[model samples]
Target: MMRALRALVRKDLTLFFEDRRAVVLSFAAPIAIGAFFGFLFSGGGGGNAKIPVRVADLDGSSVSRAIVAALEKDKALEVKSATSADEARELVRRGKATAAVILPKSFGEEAVNAFFRQTDKPDLLLLRDPSHTAEAGMLRGILTQHVMEVVSKEAFSGPAGLRSARQALRQVSEDKAMAPSDRKDLTVLLQSVVNLQEHSTSEKTEALGPQGGIGVPYDTKEEEVTAHAGETYNGYAHSFGGMALQFILMASIEFGMGILIERRTGIWKRLLAAPLHRSTLLLARGISGALISLAIFLVCMGFGMAVFGVRVQGSWPGFLLLAVAYALMASAFGLLLAALGRTPEATRGLAVFAVLILVMLGGAWVPAFIFPAWLQKATLLLPTRWAMDALDGVTWRGLGLASALPAVAILLGFTFVFALIAAWKFPSEEG
Candidate 1:
């Protein structure tokens, strides 16, 4: 029994190695995909991947200017200037910036008053898209640190420091909210701050908090912005987009493979014997394949919507247009694959590999915005990328048909090219 088993294993190994294509694909596919994943994910980490942010300094005070400069100097932030809070927020909504940090009018004055005298904390609006929630947290932390530092320097060591110190001393004495113990502590701290001005102009003063407490000066009011003003983000919209695109394309590949199988089984020979031209036969296959893929795509999206509350938040017309366009493109892609494919055994592995690469670059697994700046721009060349964007635009982005028109046009263009090439290559007996 052992001898027979060894013989069987050896025969299998020999068969596998005899087909050089099989041998190469078995090993090369994994290696290639692994390397590609490593390259793609490398963009997510490291110092070079900075979050893009817009800073709107409505308060043109010296303190606000210093804070803006400090934020600009940070390695983790790519800062741009904005004229107003609305302008900065618009950038975030449009994806031009990851977050918007708006220093409102009187922000500097109010912050200083809050710290020295017990006024309401100054509000700094932080507007961010829902997908960028992680980056928003990072920005808030960064802003907090920078604001505290800037406020501390201004309140304790700037030309107005002595004045703020005197103001704090008087306010501490008159405050009724403070406990006796806390008031005593604040009195000593304030008096010492006042004495510093008489001794040395350059002396550093410890930052004061409202009511003599220790804290950041400004309050961050975060608003999670979605595609629409009232609508919440539906994560399923994006996931469905990527997953449907992938499976529909896979189904298209199956349709293409069917042609090759029919040829092998002599069904294609009988079809070729008919009076219909090759283009006519090929177009029928393409159309049927497109309809099938579109049906699959719609079924999946319907499941997502019915179960997960995913809505077409944008234009319904745009959503349908993109979905149909992608279905056609995917069918064409399948034809191209069939025209270029060898035997089923040889083509399946290579086709899957190509599909995986397309999906990876198309932001199927992760948002393309998370990639480094260059990779984000580079994905624009891919049809899968356009498909993903168009799907998102019509779903979560609340964009109209005009916004999706470009993607629809591109998908159709790719479809035309794929079909033209497949027809040219279809007549050849060679794979």
Candidate 2:
């Protein structure tokens, strides 16, 4: 039985490889598509692309200049100075800049006073392009953090410290038993506090905040936790996973066509005349198709990793399990297609349309997260979705073997159902 199955499998492989165009289309096309998408979505090595921003600093004060310097230091933004608010707005309107930050003429003075004396706050105007709202939001966050840091520094060093010092002097003045000279000294301290409160120089950093106090303006530290530690995200990983699943389904057409041709050409009758049982012959064909699909999938992924830097950060064993299950499902689907369709021509057209729909709904072209909530739930019913999910999980998601079990089970369940249907409905040579 094993020898007969091996011979049959070898025959199928020989016939498949004889068609050079089919081989190239099945493997090379998906690799090319994955590379294109990988480059497009990866943003060329996972770095944030800089958004152009215009800064309109009308105050020209040291504080305003510090803010401008901070904005320029951010790698995510390309900061350009604008002479006027009108010029900044024009840049945003012309699509040359994503957003414009405008500081009013009294911004520096107000900002300083607001921190030290609890005075009226300054408003910084942001002119953002409506189309680039996400970029504008990011810029807003950066600006907010910078403002908080500057204010926190001023609060401790400037008015906050002077206010505390003045209260201490006022308490000392409340002592009626103090000597005249001591009282005079207390008054001097009180008056100095008032002068510092009213006419404090922004340059007096040492005299700011409470004595011996270290103020941390804000928390700028970042902490990131990934499923796979030490593994940088590779955009090509997901792209290759998605594209491999899509092309594997598309390749099912060839399997269906091959079965149809075999039945039409009386090859099925010749195979039945051999010592092999009818079920055994069908099983051999299914195994051959599954092997071919698995080979194509691996080749595509291998090419992606070699040339495009795609990495499998998760369990390789789990990834192999998913590949095998999906290949079996693909084989079963092809057999079912052949069993259901009356003619090869009709089956080809229907298989193409079906595969394309499955690919789209399976999140082959886009991440499943982009799907509407209802659609995302609905896609759970699709075998392709599970296949894509399992591949993505084990690849870029860095999921373990345990995490991939459910997807493997679902794909195997689909394979069983498809195989049962094909076995029941497959055309007999006599018919």
lDDT of each candidate versus the true structure: 0.80, 0.71
Candidate 2 residue-wise lDDT at 187: 80
Per-residue lDDT over 1-431 for candidate 2, one digit per residue giving the tens place of the 0 to 100 score: 99999999999999777666556555655675567446535554344457788999998876678788889998878899999977876566444576788887867656655553243567787876543446667887888767655554444444544554465466667878879897897687556656765566555535544332222222222111123434454667767887888888878778988888988898877888888877897798899989988998999999998999777667788889999999999999998988887667667766776787688778787554334445556788998888776676677656678767888999999999999999999866644
Error of 1 at 405 (Å): 1.2
Model 2 lDDT on a 0 to 1 scale: 0.71
Clashes of each: 0, 4
TM-scores, all candidates, are 0.88, 0.52
Over the full model, what C-alpha lDDT does candidate 1 score relative to the true structure?
Answer: 0.80
Candidate 2 wrongly placed segments (more than 4 Å) = 1-225
Q: Give the clash total for candidate 1.
A: 0
lDDT of 1 by residue, 1-431 (tens): 99999999999999878878867998999999887667656753331367899999999998899899999999889999999877876677656688888998888767765666556889999888777677888888899878877777667656565677787788878989889898999899878866765455644544343123256667888876667666788889889888999998888778888887887888888888888788888999999989998998899999999999888888899999998999999999889888877676567767788788788788787666566767667788888999887787778777778878999999999999999999998754412
